[model samples]
Target: MPGNMVTSEFLVDVDHQRCRRCKRCILNCGFGVFDFQSMTTADSSKCVACHRCVVFCPEEAITIRRNPLAFREHSSWDVDKRKAVWKQAQSPGMILTGMGNDLPWLNVFDHLLIDACQVTNPSIDPLREPMELRTFLGRKPDRVEVVPSDGGYRVQNPPENNIELDIPLIFSGMSYGSVSLNVHKALAIAAEKLGTVMNTGEGGLHQELYPYRDHIIVQCASGRFGVHSDYLNAGVAVEIKIGQGAKPGIGGHLPGEKIGREVSGTRMIPVGTDALSPAPHHDIYSIEDLRQLIYALKEATGYKPISVKIATVHNVAAIASGIARAGADIIYLDGFRGGTGASPAVIRDHVGIPVEIAVAVVDAQLRSEGIRNWVSIIAAGGVRSSADVAKAIALGADAVGVGTAALIAMGCRLCQKCYTGNCSWGIATQKPELVGRLDPDWAAERLVNLVNSWSLELKEVLGALGVNAIESLRGNRERLRSLGLDAATTEIIDVKPAGR
Candidate 1:
């Protein structure tokens, strides 16, 4: 066995005689628990018994046995582990974490299915046929009529208009302070290459990324971290992040420890001070207040389209309708199952409604109110595959924002330990060594590959639906059927039986 690092609450035993120090264990362990010393290896005593090292060792030389399992036996399996840990903490009962919203709600990814054409209809060969994934995001005209002008017929533009996207999927908001400059650079490059847009989530824009400003969407959250006149003018559109899917009622805190020199400088805050993003915007207390913020941003940015992002919870449909009438050009809905960088495990594992019900209800309500075209709907939270993207569009989303899926392509293991500021994957933490683990070139390529793959799959699904464009799938709920919906759910979602 290797020498002990400290008094052990948990320990890893490695048989040195059998261990060749091939470093397979070190390479396989997600948590860097083992380090080679002399001719053998030793444990760092931070092991959470993920067992990747023990399972990957070529020889049976490693074992991790916990010391008396600190957790008391629970009669109910419903208790959240992280919440229990928080309860055990001595002080500062706040749950600090990173990444997307984590919750055990009905995952829309699992509930929805993509309709693919079988024998009766032929799937178009993307290589041979033209398939469109273009999406327009903004308010559409309530009604349109062709009129003769001086020369020819023309259609009047609506008070608000849509911004056209080459693809239906967009890069979700991730700030420079929360992520890294290199990560932001990669996202910017990839968005430019893919002809899409990436959101600069609350974090201020870096001057280096200014050249790619045309592909960026700047976000204005409660904190207003990097908001300036020029920064507002930098993006194609502006998004007001009212509430994140994770930690909806709570605020965001980028601990002083994670606020490195670069992040501090970029966010324009003093180093070593916690970046506290308040839960609600002090100025926004109602829909009218929200409209003022929207107009303020629009005026600040010379009338750029403004989007309002909200967490999907109960009463979301009513809230969404109010948002549409609140002068927002677009409405982005984030469901409960979304991933977060760091959130209270308690908040992540509970709180909020599923995306499926939220999207359906909001769409139905908007259509019923004759305001479906008043604002574009962007569905987010736990969108996994191309199938989910297509299904979201079929359910009436103009586009979808994918965060966790994008990070997974960049080598995230979904470890749920990002708040510790020691992420091995380099996707969530601010540590220099952890950030160094990620190669921007490789990570960018992988993100591009993931998006490209999904785009192709989306085209395949559209082709299978006998449609050439993604727009055809929008709000076409007639093609969808509820598999086992209850009365309340069915009524809320307005899902009808097959052949309805």
Candidate 2:
């Protein structure tokens, strides 16, 4: 009864003067926060500002606004900080959160400035001239063999293991259980249409998606859910998820309540079973162990390229070097601002580094170690736009992974309620009623439009730099400099301060 007591952190005001109570607001609300039996208006405490009830309401009577409770301002002990303390004191459990970190940290992306070509060096026209965005993810051979054959020289010793991407953008892993089937289908179709790749986020590939195998990249996380030889072969490349940026050094457990028939089938688990992913793979205790598994998967898939994904932690650069030496053809680095299906608020906000610094530091380290070309880098976490994608490539990432942006393109509002499975946008939720709201066909078009638009913007920047191809931007730090940053911070990102 104490917990059942209603609290007004947000205000839900209904203009009763309009008088017609069709109850559209209650019917549309999936949170079941409305008590119509004795209600004048929807409960304010449960209102997430999802705008569902407001959008579907027949009468323009209901309005949702925050209560805006004020606490005496204290810089050290802010309202959120004090409230967080009270929450834990009342119930000793980790605070559950969704999406990326909302904390105000140093976003290195803001300080890094990009360059444009001057009259001395003519800028290329992407509309008329050629601009290549095609990229390959995998190990490259040290040198090409020129064999004299008959009257002409013949090329030899080609690396069969590779994952060719028509564009430098990839849909980051968002599992089937975390999101609806329609969302997955949209990503698959978009990837196929764009000639890029979509990752099945630790969830097994659905039977319906088998047709899009060429554009699929299967992830084998610590849980190993839905992993099989067939699944390995189905994808052009297989990624081993060592850790996620949202919850570094911690395991994840999807509650049994979320498990549905489709999710069960895809994960090869029984219904009502909690899907658990451990912090570390039981077999992968060291770099050697990782190498063994990478080789094993490659062998199983007849030498398909293997990708090892790790969060951007303190020792990320050293860890990346170890992974590169361990024979992973591709290294996937996820930063602190990455989104998650669900994660502990403490971990999501506090763990890992930013993607900009991670990519820059790792790239510099790999180059110094003389193994930069041995493995491709895919920068992830908080890649919000094409500027991010272009900057990431310039920071030495071969490509970038976008999860939250792609979800938003499919109509997500970033309400941070993904853990509740009541996403009105129909992308994050699995509820049958809510899932029906999204049309795969429509969602795919939106995703295609988003990617194509961003790609065009990328080309525009490349043209202004007088670079005709995207590859020429990779590791070209000379084209970027800091606006105003500390010497130590600039040194970490390995970019020079403005004005030489």
Consecutive 10-residue window with the lowest summed lDDT within model 2: 1-10
Best candidate (score: TM-score):
2
lDDT of 1 by residue, 138-256 (tens): 87877886788889988876445457778998888988867767788888888888888999988888999999988899998889898888889898999999987876777788889
lDDT tens digits, residues 1-500, model 2? 36632245567788887637788787777776565664456777787777777777777778878777777899999777777776787788988988899999988888888899998999999999989999989998877788998999888877557788989989998888888899999999999999999999997889999899999999999999999989999989999999888888887788786789988999999998999989899989999999999999988989888999898999999999999999999999999999998999999999999888889888999989989888999999989889989889998899999999999888776778888888877877878988998899899999999999999999999999999999999989888889877899888777888888
Error of 2 at 63 (Å): 3.1
What lDDT score belongs to each candidate, Candidate 1 first?
A: 0.79, 0.88
TM-score of candidate 1 versus the correct structure, residues matched by position: 0.87
Model 1, position 264: C-alpha lDDT score? 82
